[model samples]
Target: MMSSCAHPLHGKSVETQHKTAATTSQQEKALADIAAETQTTQPAPVAQNPLLDGLPASDIAGVQADAKRIYSNHWGPVSERSRYVRARILPILKDMGAPRQLEVVPVAESGYNPYAFSPVGATGLWQVMPGTARMLGMNAAKGYDPRRHVEESTRGGVQYLQEMYAMFGNWPTAFAAYHRGPGNMTRRLAQHPWKPQDGLDTMPVPPVTMTYVRGILGLSALVQRGLWTFPEPWETHQVSIEGPIDVNQLAEAAQIDPEELYRFNPGLNHSQYLDSQIVLHVPESMLQPLLANAGQAAPEYVHAKVRKGDNLSVIARRYHTSVHDLKRINPDLSTLLQPGQTLLVPAGHMDSTSPPLNPLLAQGRRIHYRVRNGDNLWNIAKRFGTTPAAIARANSIKSDKTLHPGDRLWLLARARTS
Candidate 1:
């Protein structure tokens, strides 16, 4: 919980556990293992770190001391959650052309806990109010709040920060304006203006606002300084569609968990939908498959030649498009057809691949072979990169189906789910 901000949580207490020798060793080894396994190198620091944004945080006596104390105590336990938070935001900040330093703003706002909610109606890592989220281009309706999505919320937060900076002409003031509404700041300035020599915290703003800005700036410093060991960047890639897409189908074809997909694309409506376009970030390995599936699943179509005996109904079914859509895309398709003529049509499932059948599905590959001596399902599965259950299912046999030397069986390959 934040020491001060939208909600003070002043009476709330945080829990911490001391690490035993065994757990400490485990943590060190885990860190080393992660370092070895990570594919991403450290990102080069830009001339201007967004984390600093060259802003002076509150120098009030409590600010510095409280920030340090908060950092030591709040982060005393498992660092995995902290790593997850950093991993999600770094890519977003880079993509937005915002400072990587700006990432800790979410942590300051809500500990980068997307599900964190406040009675004040603030929600998500950025702790944006529903009204503010909507105003800043985030969909927060129907319990499908995109603000809860890490990337989407980062985009919204970045946009808001940019607006604040553009208006205030300085990062400190921009940060102040973000925590306290611009109108409130303006009104406060009108009532009691301070000379340029006087720092901002001296102004007639609430102490909470000052603490908010200070926390964000101080937390950003802690993260950058290696005092907090943020995780390595995630190994992932993203695709930007020209328009909004059916992310569910795209997730299914890619074989990724749908919830994970939503986590990467929180800009979509939280509930049913509110109609808008957004990007899709997926694991680096699944990028190509997702793109290929998206292309095939897209409403767009390809051309197919009509074979002999292909009537309108037959052609419509051949392509996965409706007969009405066929007529619309290809005018007079319902009225006329030639055996060898090409026509526009939605992509068929077979057309999803460059060739309708891979070499594995060719007639030569389909030819059944009799079970050989010493052959087992494991060996067959290894040979074909398919599961034994898939092979048994094809022949309508039990998973434990035993094979004898004269038994004929068909081999069907299966794609591995990511």
Candidate 2:
């Protein structure tokens, strides 16, 4: 019965074939101390996978055809991040009993920009932006990059999809809400603007957003029937982490490269996962030591367990440190820590005051921009297609209006691009 319950998607979707022992619930949540593990028997989410999960085969067939057309039209450059997203989501879909056809949604959604932002500002490989990331408790700094952590992002994305499903009671409606947000979808529905409240019928939405929801269903169907192939082949894995640590640290501990970690955990960014809890991903045998260490404490780094009412200043003071020092070592410190959480304190480093590193430094280039006489920060920024604050940050200019002609400014587009 347990195996049958787990194989609920058999004969229905390709996602069933993707599930493996690595992503079983027993391993995915194995990060906590032994005592915190639970043995509750919960049904897999296949029945409630999405609104479209219950659609008639005929309807799904139609969606599959439409999705292929749309995806083919908008295909763009394949980004490493997109590849990473595929790697993370495929395993999750299988684990949760989602159909394999679901893979098409990412392919269509990948065209806009590597950092596609909806009007609501969801961002990254999965389009999860800062605001939504915060809502999901993802830290953007301290090198904890959840946006770069594929598993965390996939989990968050799935959770978000599930919430939308609950609200509209259908896959199509939920997809629209996911893009436009429930607030806007509700407003559109109240006005009776486009189609009906029924997502399948399509009452009204921006044409692009409407197409987006349909594409997700359609492409998902195509992938299901094997009518389309994911442009890239992504092998799947199930990984488990054991301790509170940053993604970089986990990469080190796992004996896997940081890029590999980024491939598996797209939700992490330097800030969002400074001292993140244990995360799971595709298991790599080489990372066994790191995986084991991730569940335990490490030396050469201070692991501060957050207590109630502990803010940055309090935490710093308790450790005979300064908030500036704390922020310095934890570059994304601003984003990662919460009360009752744990943080990784680097040895002997405190003070969050280091100048932001040139984002291009990681890629081995020093980006420079020349100041124009008529250019204020905003104008200079607009000319370069960046934010004024970014220009200011690059040049270390205190006054937005202050700039001297011929001053060379570092253009940090690489960071923004990432």
Candidate 3:
């Protein structure tokens, strides 16, 4: 059930109030459930030095205190869920060579929302967008949603941020580029260069990106001071798949929910997994068969010569498949195809046991809203005729009081019974 204050914005913006009126929006109700869970549960205290059992006493105590504080602060409102996501991402942070302190701040910056996006189109919990994600080999598709995969997304975020640092020669510039694409910052820095004394203050950036840096800094300070709490460490296992596979198919093969798969392997594209090896994360219970099947041969495709006016979408439609499937089966097909060039198209029911196809249509509809400057949760919620809590609930948001410009919030209908 929604909170008693759920219907607070009865007269808000009609255009944005589809959560109550649209029928096909299942994500809205799911987010509502998340909000309810956030309001009711109190998370257990996370161990501060997961790695401290063998450490010196002095180090153990300091690590423990830092862990506790970061855990607490990280769980501003939705402690349990926030902690869950933080725990999932902890290993990734460690793998990225992030200090314990740096790990906690990202949880704060993202509030555990894996799909967070910046105004300049950066996406994921780490806010990596399509272009950057592609460069890092993180594919975004229906069954293989890379944005939801903590390990891939976090690793890509680290790499992207490091690249930004190399470009601007400073953490602040790197972070600013994270919020407002590196291209924008590079242009600005070239036109209005800064002195050592000016620091980040002299850089020409949007107020929201500026505040994003501050937010990261604030989170880093709090976490460093041992002011937040973290979630319990959930065991992570690897699932390997071979050949042309789709994430949803792999999820079914493992007998786990697709959402769970996405949560762990957010770097996957939705439509299909190309004919290459991929290691996905899953609970320990579902790891065996996935690994065993990793050695199986990928489905072979027939070489079909391309004709004029042949696009992935059209070709996929002709073959009763999706553009994603086409892309996966034919990774060599560039955007511009030659008239006589051959492309590998999946033929027949080779993988009949796999999940139902048409993932493109299945995951088709989405609402994307651009974040405006000086916008807050209250204004956004009011604009949507939804409470701040509802908006927060929908987006895995912890605090219903803060926001950043260039941020994108996905809205769906909660009460539209279709």
- Please write out the lDDT profile of model 1 over residues 1-418, one tens digit for every residue: 1112532200111112212211245434643443343325442321133433322222322333556666556554323444444566776666665666676676667665554544333556676655575576664333244555666567777777767666655555667777877777677778887421254456566777766766766665445544455656455565755432345555677776666665444433321111334455566766887777764334344456778888888876766657888789887664567766777665433342121111111222232646768777766664443567767887898878788887877764321110
| Candidate 2 residue lDDT tens string, 131-249 | 46557665433344454455555555566665665666555766777777888878887887432222354546777775676677765544443444455645545554433444555
Worst 10 residues of 1 by lDDT: 9-18
lDDT of the structure predicted as candidate 3: 0.49
Q: What is the C-alpha RMSD of each candidate to the true structure, in Å?
A: 21.2, 16.1, 18.3
| Decreasing lDDT order of the candidates | 1, 3, 2
Candidate 2 least-lDDT 10 residues: 1-10
Lowest summed lDDT across 10 adjacent residues in model 3 is found at 1-10
Candidate 2 off by > 4 Å:
1-65, 73-87, 90-102, 111-121, 139-142, 193-202, 231-389, 392-418
lDDT of 3 by residue, 242-314 (tens): 6565555555665667676555554454335454556666667667756654434243454456778887776
Specify the highest-TM-score model's number: 2
CA displacement after TM-score superposition, residue 170 of candidate 2 (Å): 1.4
TM-score of each: 0.46, 0.49, 0.46
Off by over 4 Å in 1: 1-64, 76-79, 85-88, 139-144, 194-197, 237-418
Name every residue pair that clashes in candidate 1: 51-101, 144-270, 144-271, 145-270, 146-266
TM-score preference between candidates 2 and 3, better one: 2
